[model samples]
Target chain A: MKGIIYGLVFFVSLFCSSFAVAIASKPIVVASTTQIADFARQVAGDRLIVKCVLAPGADPHTYQPTPDDVQMVLESDICLENGLHLEGKNWMSTLATDAGKPIITTTDGIKPLAISSEGEMVADPHAWFSPKNVAVYVNNIVKGFSQLDPDGKQNYEARATLFLQQLRVLDSWVRQQINRIPTQRRILVTTHDAFNYFCTEFKLNANNNFLSIAPVGWSTGAEVGGGMTPERRRKVVQSIKESGAPALFVETTINPKQIREIAKETGVKIGGELYSDSMGPEGSAGETYIGMMRENVLLMVNALK
Target chain B: MRFLLVVTIWVVIVGGLWGYIADRDTRRQQITAATPMDLSVEGRFVIEVTPTFSTEKDPFALTTSDSSVPPLTVKLNGMYIDTHTQEVLRGQTLRYEDVSGVLSGHNEIYVSASPPLSENTLEHGVRVKLYEDSTLVVDQTVWADQGALVSGTISFNHSADEEGSHDH
Candidate 1:
């Protein structure tokens, strides 16, 4: 009996010590969205452990933080978020503040496209749609991570350099792919305003003033400048009818019913689902950021061209 | 005795996991560091860029403060050699001095530029010519599918001294 008691105490202490060691060895970075988490992972590599508050295909505009997310934030050294109110009601910022963790806004230096909502213009938060904007995100993450772990600065920079080059390549490739669509047929109609950056980058939705045609506002949430409205829906349908948009696309994170209805009303086919607010789930082509963009472009070209 | 055995088993499992993770991390870092950029210089060379389409700032391209940067990027042996602010018109040859980092024996020039997406229906290309002093050492045209960015590599051989002299 005495031996068993001593051994049990020893084992418990050893286990706790090992757990502490593991936690201390690497710092944790909690990201608000899967895309930001993916970018952090690409730059940090194995130096930092990156965790996403929102799971794959989860809508950032409507994401509610769970108790687990709070716990994760509590343990994380830093938090990253796509600001401009991408997080509905600033949930990520609230969590980070409550947990006393520094929150880095990844979209720090991007020139956000403004969208009008109810006579007021709001900065669009879906900057990742343009690979150029994502480069800004990468740079911000590198700076944030380097501040946290100065020793790993060179490693982070090297990884970021490579990733930036890849982004340039992806940008070039996407331009090439978008060229396949006839100039007039380059119209893009999606479920929401999340594609304004993408359409503007690729020169789509010419009839809609070179922006995206969508029934929903920038955010699918009930934010001030968000959610679907009857006026917006009517405009989308009219724009599609006038532009002769080849097809309409639904987002994986949003309900397809709205887009389907619009497509039916406009007499156009659903091009395909796009990974907008979030990326696709694991084992899917849209798993990584690059993968998501590539698949979206391929689907657009195939449907429109 | 049972508790002692359980503790021993846990130790082995935890130790193995740590070892595996450490090894994996080291391997990843090594792989990242293995690819080093070749910055060794051979000599001065001139590169001419002639675009088949109008050059404009790609809204999707990586932003640079220099507004005069032409739509095209010409890299010599992985280094951006064209930094001139001059506008490269369609079929107009714009010359730049690629003054350093020309590797002897075999050299490569990478050219990438976005053709206007509006002209996606027409296939476009850019002709790149490399001249060492007046002799054209390498001439290659990089073409792109209708609506794609023009990206291709131009390779050539040059036999010169360490001082970049062609002594007969």
Candidate 2:
């Protein structure tokens, strides 16, 4: 009887401890991608428990809503999403709908550009890539946090103010980086339509076949919808040659084979990797939005200049 | 013992079903709530490009709407202006709440209190112009790092440069 009583007490203590930890945890704010989660964290400060559904290097285009993701949304206070049809069409709305949380579309306020490649007006979701669009995102995030946790509204606003300062520094740094590349060599080439806002903000043209300004909705796994044959590869090579871009770049998610082939064919070096559609892994250089932009500018300067 | 077993089973099954139903209902309600109030609003304000005087909690107010319509559960209201005031706001607080959200978006509610003129004016207390399909809502604060509003060619830049600074 004494042993039974001792066991009950021990179990109860363990249960109580577990419960205490869970209760002590802050409300989670989940974003669809790392770039957003980073921004949310900046605005939310210590008050919010923030995370992204798409892990580093994971493509946001094909991000399937996992059961765990749904559960996370269900439990989280807010879900930040890039709403220019950024999270593909299917997974995002479902997750937002399932979670019942206020899914904040960060790019809702701005007049988004309909960057076209062929005839169709391709949707560009890479607004966060550009500091300008990110301003809109930062605002939306602050608003979301304020609504969800009004008690910490003051803190959210204060932190957002500070983060904006850092972002301003980052923008000037990017402009400086672009200035490094001679005007003639100011051509940005990368995977997919991720850098449209970046190009628009920085005055660079998105004229690469491999990298379309519009959301063509192609993952690196497939050859941009269909297979990229030798002929299609020839066009990319020819464009790079005619444009005289100082460098051609590959994205973190895409395998570097196609871009490498284009570079080899065109005698241009592949200018490292760009954080398109997603941020870098935790502890990496391009992990946060500002860090990602800083790293991108640094890479662009080193490659083009 | 048999009755107790039946009761426990009934409770468990019924409770699980109820939980599922309740969760579904909750998500639907949230979506429905967001769906109706798709009305867009835009508010604009101009601050001194470089305020020598400290703006610690300076009331840069844009009197838009008084809180209305179940408060609409304000989504976001960050500001993205263009200027060189980045250095000015260091170590300062920029607190915005329900009043802040209304001031940024929803100008119709408080248009009466707003300055008489309908253009960007300082003494006019941030003149506002409304659009039926289109509106301008700039209450969110974005840094020079990521402050660009894409409307035709109007880049908010969120900078305080003299050229970028339009008369508010």
Candidate 3:
């Protein structure tokens, strides 16, 4: 009886150790944002372990990389970042480079929407706002994973194809939902110019050149054309008054003081807190990329329609 | 006796795990490669795609930078039949003659098109009319919700006897 008990214990320990080794052997993929992390997980599935540098609702524009983040990148096999300056001061790239880890820019191969900031045309880093651009992100991530783990290429590609189809469905759903709002009343006002891609894709603010209207420029950080400007504030106020926008909105990542003050002065109600730079926390409606877009569209339609 | 029992238990556990993993791998492979439809199944079929409303480019459509990829895609039995890159007017019935892979017993025609985003409040549909040598075989209208893509599969059974009769 004693020998049997010992043998059973040894067998269980061996199985447990083998399982742990299998899990540890899988490559780790560290992403810059929660949304990127979600996309990586969707493609990589259980083949690769995915980690996010920025927490949910954490602003990537002004996110300061911590020592823990550096250690995470150093231990990671690969790093993914939304290039075109979405990460403030190129923090994600800098971390990956310093750690000597291969980095994949998810937004690669996208025909970026350019924004005129401080007399210079800068590529808007909010390409994920449009699902079409997100297809590019998923494709790039698939390529990155396949290159790293050649054996998992077929697995990654299959998952990416399914995710791409889901994105197509999401795009069509968003359009149908946005169609609920009348064209003339489709004025989208938010904290920053984060929704420029969204507005361009959905034809919001058609009267205002089919672009987003906000008090802040593209980035929330103090880049050349970023941060809040007096002229930009005046323009936002003027546009809201001229267009008779039904409501204004604040972002979860940025401080709502500026937009709130504008709303108070202009007598426009704050429609809702939108998920911009980051997604909602775990268990929230805006937790996933599709969920965030759906919630944002629903909020906008309800307020404007 | 104790040694034999322990070895038997170990073999059973390990063998069960191996069987589970092998089964899982086989299932995954099956999902990865879709069952290829028989394109050799021949029929003189003409599929007509008639939109209830004008088809426009969906702003949020998942398309590559490739200019030639059409906004409207129609597939017959999992094979590409025709694609329209530009706006397909309401009255214009885009027709296709060479539709392959259609099974003789049961056939499927898939239609996916972007309805005008501006007309999202109103439900829209695409009328898929299939004619077997001028004899209408299948007439089905696939509808989408107010603002969604008009995408659905129209299935019908085709028999050799129904070639000239409008039975199916």
Candidate 4:
């Protein structure tokens, strides 16, 4: 009887250990940016572990992946990235490719704005400026998560639907707020050309040639002021002078010296600091993507109105 | 009676050990053999305008006309798989989830425009990429004139080990 009791204990322990392992195991999902990670968490919930490579307030366009990021990718079951060269030097792509992990580009289905840099037209990578575009991001994320874990399809879809409804409400609210400002006063002058999608969606451009006039170009690479050439500067100054923009605004990720100078040159007061390249830091009003966009629009309306 | 009891206890011990080892091996095999259940297909389409006049005469004509012209768009009219049909605009990326059992050896994607564009209205091209899990399997580009129906085929076995082929 004693030997039998010991054998039964051993069997029960082994069975319990396997069960514990099964319960604790969850797929790891690594997102390239905070915004993408937030979206993944909304859809993934408790089904997967979501991690972000770029922390809040980190500029995606100039971010570099560390060796730790490579190890994280290797261990991750799936990786998500905002393609369209948003990772500056394509560091996210390089990390995922090197680690042989599956990667989903969150901006896979959104229509991008074409901005001219050095007389060459390039697709603007900042699609999340508009809530409608973020809806597309949510959809792609749902598909990615469902593919990674088919058993969680219903869970992801349900969460995505709820989030998408919130986005629609946000879009409607933005339109209503912007409507308060006069059509001619809808011009948004920022440091970089990141608000083209916002301008296009809200009909805020003065003309097709100049959509959301800015001192800097679309990206902040090795090029001076993100390819802000002398000609481009002259054009922006001319546009501001012609349009008589009410105010100029700076971004969260970029330095405000250049925009401040532009404001001084144009004699326009700095409206407010807007979240551009990256969202606001934790514990702030603009910490989440939705919060960031709402704060930006409110600031724009109050400044431009 | 003592001999029988000892033998029964030994049998129980041996059986428990054997069962534990077999279960561990089975679980290991299950983990090693697991494959992804879906593949990602992503691509973009662009519409190009072909001018009927010379550059000097119409240097600003295209620009002026484009200003009057509405935003040009395209749609995914159909796919060989029934569930994958959806609309995609020009200059926008399209990503389709090709789940297991929904895709087969050969698949076709058909594109069409609403209200039918004229032959000289615009020219369009498509670039598609297929990925099995994270590994790129195939990439191809196809072009067609305005008002012409555009279609492309992607071929691959359902097996996770096989790479897909994109025929333009």
Best by DockQ: 3
Model 2 spans > 4 angstroms off: A1-25, A206-226, B1-168
Give interface RMSD, every candidate, in order: 6.6, 12.3, 4.6, 16.8
Which runs in model 1 stand beyond 4 Å of their true positions? Answer: A1-24, A216-219, A223-240, B1-168
Put down candidate 1 lDDT per residue, A77-144, tens digits, no spaces.
99999999899899999999999999999999889999986789999999999888998898789889
Q: Given candidate 1, what's the lDDT at residue A8?
A: 63
lDDT of each: 0.80, 0.59, 0.83, 0.67
Error of 2 at B118 (Å): 28
True contacts kept of each: 0.10, 0.02, 0.29, 0.00
- Between the candidate structures 1 and 4, which one is better when assessed by lDDT? 1
**Tens digits of per-residue lDDT for model 2 on B6-102?**
5555567567978999999999999887854533423343221221122221111111114221200112233332212222332233322223222
- Compared with the true structure, what per-residue lDDT tens digits does model 4 show for residues A92-111? 98898989999999998777
The docking quality of candidate 1, as DockQ, is: 0.12
Residue B92's lDDT in candidate 4? 52
Model 1: residue A183 alpha-carbon error in angstroms: 0.9
Please tell me which model should have the higher lDDT, number 2 or number 4. 4
Alpha carbon lDDT at A303, candidate 2: 89
Local accuracy of candidate 1 as per-residue lDDT tens digits, B79-119: 88775444467788878875576765677888877666567
Candidate 2 chain A: worst 10 consecutive residues by lDDT? A209-218
lDDT of residue A27 for candidate 1: 93
Better of 1 and 2 by lDDT: 1
